[model samples]
Target chain A: MYEFEFVKPTTVADAVAALGEEEAQALGGGQTLIPTLKQRLAMPATLVSLTGIAEMKGVKAEGGTVTIGGGTTHGTVAKEAASAYPALAALASNIGDPAVRNRGTIGGSLANNDPSACYPAAALASGATIVTSSREIAADDYFQGMFTTALEDGEIVTAVRFPVPEKAAYIKFEQPASRFALVGVFVAKYADGVRVAVTGASEEGVFRWSEAEAALSANFSAAALEGLSVPADGMIGDLHGSKEYRAHLVGVLTKRAVAAA
Target chain B: MTKISMKVNGKEVSGEVEGRTLLVSFLRDTLGMTGTHVGCDTSQCGACVVHVDGAAVKSCTMLAMEAEGAEVATIEGQANADGTLSVVQQAFQDHHGLQCGFCTPGMVMSATALLKDNPKPSEAEIRHYLEGNICRCTGYHNIVKAILAASGQLEGAIAAE
Candidate 1:
């Protein structure tokens, strides 16, 4: 790991100011960033830690919306958000393990945007709003690709607001060794319609399964997806699973999610 | 080098470390607290697990500066002032939870954190919580028994105590 200047900012404004420095990166949870650093994958001039900002650390639920500060760790969300959003809370509780849950934040998970991560599926399926230091980005727009997001340099995510859904469920087929998803699917039923987001299996990263959404939105049952199939062309293939197997799991998990929802 | 100050093992300690210095390095090297082991540098191995602000966290995954001013606890702190082992630690010994003893510190630390939060965790819960703490020697059976015994989840073990 390369030596770099470390700065802890107490406010969003201060964080943005610190990040404005050339080649500075915002640190949240440090679960992913620190590991990446240990591998010497990135060398920045400064690290702006958002953990010190009191304002950017909380879980609030009101008016049918659940808003969580970007700095809030997965443990907090798992404990605090259960009443308001059980599915999201369940998803948070299952990430990594007790130790990982204590240090990994929702914001970090979303910002890092690992294709196998669980939060992207939830955020996209729930249509959560990601609030950055400068602007708010819809989940669809926030995720650009694997390990990528629409975040501009110096842009710090402050919080994520999830409009509570009437029904939601997440099913994860995990890579046993790492606990990351081999194929994970989140199905959310809103008043307007249903949204299905699949992760871990895609080459293009977390993507909404519009076909299953259209089917489930109309029928709102596992049986509705009886004959549906997700294409294996763009699915990720690795030691854990084949592309075709992942595609099949995606469909199976989505159906399970809808049924659970 | 960055100056970091925090409470470790109930004592306030300060040290200067590189910005890239991991919390485990600070605890093991700077403070000379060798009880915390680093089985794997990567976060997958829970041998580096410790209590930061009363929660179990992968010490290797966090920078030392990130833990500045936070209350940190490690395996060294698990023993009584008289050098007697902690309940969690004693349970492991009583149940033959460790063989190679490499993963003992992390297993004990994680178990302490678990029992602190949930005084009486079921056998299933013990297995779930031990997901991060790997015990290849005993195949996790004795380790799980130790945690369950420590948590008072096993009636026979409680009677033995």
Candidate 2:
């Protein structure tokens, strides 16, 4: 890893001020950033550590919504959000492993915007509100693409607010080596309608499947998804699985998520 | 270089480390505590697992500066006060959980954390909990057995298997 100045700020304002420095980067849990640094994939003159900010580390449920502090670890979410959002908790519990969960933060995961990550699907499907240090961004507009987001320079994701759905479930077909989602689907049913988001399969990153959402909203069941299929085009294809396979898995996992929900 | 202080195995230690120095490097090189091995630097392998503030985390992935004023525990701290093996370590020995022994430290650390959280994890739970800690040898059967035995659920685990 390259040498850089590391500063741990106790407040988000301090962190933002630190991050405003030239070549400054925000460090969350470092579950992904640390590895990237080790590989010399990125280099910055200063690292603004966000984990030390006490106010940005917790899970709170109120007003029919669950608000998760950005710096909150996946393990914390798994335990604390279980009652408020079991589907999100279960998704958090399965990310990487126990050790990874302890270090990986929801803010970090959402900030990285890894296409294979689990949080994006949940955020998008739940229509979450991403509260940043500067302003709040709707999850729908927050995720831009794989390894991309709507975040500007020095902007930090401070929290994510998820509306507690009546019924929700996330089903992930993990890529064995990394445990990342090979093809994952999150199905969420609200009082008004249903939302289905697919991850890992698309090269365009996590996206809502409107067709599946329409069908499921009309009839919330596995049977409602009959004859519906995701297009293989634009899906990610690698040694792990072909694009077609991922597309098929998307459909299959969506059905499973709907059924499970 | 940054001067950082932390409690390692209950010993308050201070050192000068580069901004990029990982916690495992601090424990092993800076403090001469080599029990925490770095089997894989990319954080996939659990050989660098350690307890940072009572939670198991990959030391290799965490910068030493991040552990400032934190209580860090590694494989070197697993033994009892009298230097006897920890319950998890003893069970590993009894069950022959290791062959190459390369992943033992991480496996033990992860297992100990698992048992702390779930006192009596079933075979499936143990396996699921151990997803991060990979053991190329022993096929993880003996490792599972050792963790179950340490948790006093050996009989149930064996029957389930």
Candidate 3:
């Protein structure tokens, strides 16, 4: 790893100020960034450690909304929030493994926005708000593409607020090597309507399958997704699964998720 | 450079390390606690698992400075002061849970923490909880058995001494 300056800021304000420096990255769990740096994929001049900042941790549910601190680990969310958000908790429980869940944070997962990540699908389906230091971004607008996000330089995602759904479920077909999703579906029913988000099978990145959503909205049932075919035009293709396979999986997992919901 | 002061194995230790220094490196190099091995540079392997403030975490995936003022427990701390092995450690040994033992320490630490939180976890729950700690040897059947035996809920099971 390249030599760099380290600053442990005790407050969010201080952490934000430190992050404003040229080529400084906020260290949240370090489940992703540290490995990237060690492999020479990222070379930041400084690292602003956010662990000392007390505010960026915990999970709270109130007023039909669930707010998770940006620094909250997947394991905590899985074990602690299992009763309130079963799908999200189950999704968290299945992430990488116990150690990964212990070290990987929800905010880091969102900011990094890996193409096969599970949290983005959950966020999009739950209609969560990505609250940052500058502004709040809707789940739809937050994700841009694979390993890409709408966050500008120095913009730190502080928390995520998910509106509690009447019912929700997330299901994924994981790639054996990395255990990332090959095709993941998150389904949620709000007071207004049902939302469905798909991850891990898009060349343009995470997207919603409106056809499946429309079908499920009309009647929430597994049979509703029987004939739906997600377009293969911009879906991702890899050795583990072809675009067609992923497209097919989108329907299957969507049906399974709706059934589970 | 970052000056990190934290509790390791119940002792408060302080050190000044580079920003890029991983918590595993800090524990092994600076603190001389080499029990927490680094199996994979990426966060895939659980060889470097440790407890940060009573929660199991991957030390390799975190920076040393991130653990400042936090309580950390490594495999070295699992044994009693009288040199008696921890219940999980004894379980692993008696059940022949490990062969090469590269992943044993981490496996034991993670399982210990799991049992602490959920004392009466079922067999499936034990397997699910240990998904992160991979072992190439023993096929994990014995590891699961060891954890179940250590939990002390199984009637007529001999304690791994």
- TM-score of each model's B chain? 0.94, 0.97, 0.94
What digit string (tens of lDDT, one per residue) describes model 2 on residues B6-87? 9998999999998899999999999999988899899999999999999999999999999999999899999999999999
Off by over 4 Å in 3: B154-161
Q: Sorted on lDDT, highest at the top, how do the candidates line up?
A: 2, 1, 3
What DockQ do you compute for every candidate structure? Answer: 0.83, 0.90, 0.75
Per-residue alpha-carbon lDDT of candidate 3 for residues A5-47, written as tens digits (9 for 90 to 100): 8888877888889999999988777777888888998888988
lDDT of all predictions: 0.91, 0.95, 0.87
Clashing pairs in 1: none
Say which prediction, candidate 1 or candidate 2, comes out ahead on TM-score. 2
Q: Score chain A of each prediction against the true chain A by TM-score and list the results.
A: 0.99, 0.99, 0.97
* TM accuracy, model 1: 0.98
Q: Pick the candidate with the highest DockQ.
A: 2
lDDT by residue for model 2 (A127-185), tens: 99999999999999999999999999999999999999999999999998899999899
Q: How many residue pairs in model 2 have overlapping backbones?
A: 0
Q: Give Cα distance to truth, residue A117, candidate 3, Å.
A: 0.7
Fnat, model by model in order, equals 0.83, 0.85, 0.94
